[model samples]
Target: MIELNDVHKHFGPKTVLHGVNLTIPKGESMVVIGGSGTGKSVLLKCILGLMTPDAGTILLDGQDVARAERDAFLARFGMLFQGAALFDSLPVWQNVAFRLLRGSLARPKLEAREIAIEKLRRVGLKPDVADLYPAELSGGMQKRVGLARAIAAEPEIIFFDEPTTGLDPIMAGVINELIREIVVEMGATAMTITHDMSSVRAIADKVAMLHDGIIQWTGPVAEMDASPDPYVDQFIHGRAEGPIEAVR
Candidate 1:
């Protein structure tokens, strides 16, 4: 399980997260939705230890992540970044095997390459594609490669940031389906941050709406449509006349 209790983070004069509290049950996919600059990304960063909260406790499987060994804590999770974040200089196989090659959890080169190829196959990529670099692939292929890397380490938990950000509707659906499949296959606890309603519908078991630096509402995906919360209603309907104001 992942739990954040009374978390607070500030950047100089700006406070991003304010007493944000949430608990994600084990093996569940929780999707957090919010508008841009509403601290959704900051919350993920705090959970990942890329940024620390000034106050609060973040626990992963009952262990305090804020104080845990950074490397050890991070090793328990895999992340699929907003942009695939693949290294243009490296071949797809090498990118997927990155952790297995240079970190404390390093494996032998041959074994790592084998594992990378296996993960690539898991994400619906052919073995021959592994020899290609990120620049040689299309956006959808890059996403597949990112998915391959995410599962390469076989992490206990996975974090996906805007998994379908730039994809067309069909491609977005494919990525969402792939994410759902991988999470279930690995039995990994998943938390995804996104603005795409299609992604939320495809990937979420539970949906949490982040607004004004706090979780405004949370419930099963089935209950989201009928939710009485105006903020959620506004977001899902894509309206400009609701409580959420358009920034200048």
Candidate 2:
């Protein structure tokens, strides 16, 4: 459903992505794994139209999307950013229904809150939590709220940026399982960028490793562990010595 061909992006003197190419099939979950500063998030921003590439193209469902109408293109996507990215001032329900509360897709305030409550329930959050501000919730609750928000619009494609970051291992596992269940339930195409191997195993149908601004290896999750590529092996196994260098 999504394709990137020779996609390149540069920020002044730094080149982030170089001729990156990959394809995500419809309703499939693809997890992108990489070290810090490897452009995983940048690649996502480029696809989301928050950043324009210096060269090449990105296609969504065969339509050239690199330069598509920004609003139209973004409307089809939902994103759960690192650290939840919620507005502290808004109530949880309002945050979840932010998009639906404005413009053409806007609904009655009562209806929007009802839908938000329903979505929160789907993510295993209670109705009572909907009225709380983001700062009032625990990290896990905030992440669950983020998930509810991402799926509130029932978007065809969803991007998860470091969903497990900053959470305890158990909480991260819970989020991973929830993400997997939601993706399956909604049949949404998912692209997740995370460094957590457990997240990769729980949420990925396929896995791609990015290094030095390009994909170094990609294959089914089952093959990731046994892959012969030194880079993939190093990443999956958390090895201290391999083709992947340790970050300073």
Candidate 3:
């Protein structure tokens, strides 16, 4: 459903993505794994139109993303930010319903709240939690809230950024399961960028290793462990040696 062909992006004199190419099929999850400063965020931002690539093309369902209408293009996608990114002052329900309450998806406040509550339930949250502020919730609760918001609009595509970054292992596992289930239940095309190996196993059908500003290796998740690529090996096994140089 999504394709990137020889995509390149640079900052000043530094090139981040060097002719990166990737494909994500419809209704499947693709996880891109990379260490910090490897330009995963840059690749994502370029695809989302947050930043324009210096060259090459990105297509969504065969339509050029760069030439597509911004609002309409964005309407087909949902995002869960790394930080949860809730409105500090709004109640949880309002936060989840933010997109539904404005712009093209606007609905009556009551109806939006009802949909938000339902989405929260899908993410294993109770309706009673809706009235609380983000500050009142635990990290796990906050992540669930963010997940609820991401699916509230029922977008055909979803992007998850470091979905298990800060939570404890158990909670991270919960989040991963929720993500895997939701993507399957909703049949949404998912692209996730994370360094967490647990998340890759739980949420991905296919995995790609990004290094040196390109896709170094990619294959079905089941084959990731046995892949002979040194970069993929170093990353999945958490090896300090190999092709990847650990920063001191």
RMSD of every prediction: 1.2, 1.0, 0.9
Model with the higher lDDT, candidate 2 or 3: 3
Task: List, residue by residue over 92-144, the lDDT tens digit for candidate 1.
Answer: 99999999999898989999999999999988889999899999999998998
Ranking by TM-score: 3, 2, 1
Give per-model TM-scores.
0.96, 0.97, 0.98
Q: Show the lowest summed lDDT stretch of 10 residues, model 2.
A: 66-75
| CA displacement after TM-score superposition, residue 85 of candidate 2 (Å) | 0.6
Best by lDDT: 3
Give the C-alpha miss distance for residue 89 in model 2, angstroms: 2.0
TM-score of 1: 0.96
**Cα lDDT tens digits for candidate 3, 110-179:** 9999999999999999999999999999999999999999999999999998999899999999999999
Model 1: ten consecutive residues of lowest lDDT = 239-248
Which whole-number lDDT from 0 to 100 does residue 185 have in model 3?
Answer: 94
Cα lDDT, model 2, residue 56: 81
Error of 2 at 225 (Å): 0.9
Can you write out model 2's per-residue Cα lDDT over 16-39, one digit (the tens) per residue?
Answer: 898899999999999999998999
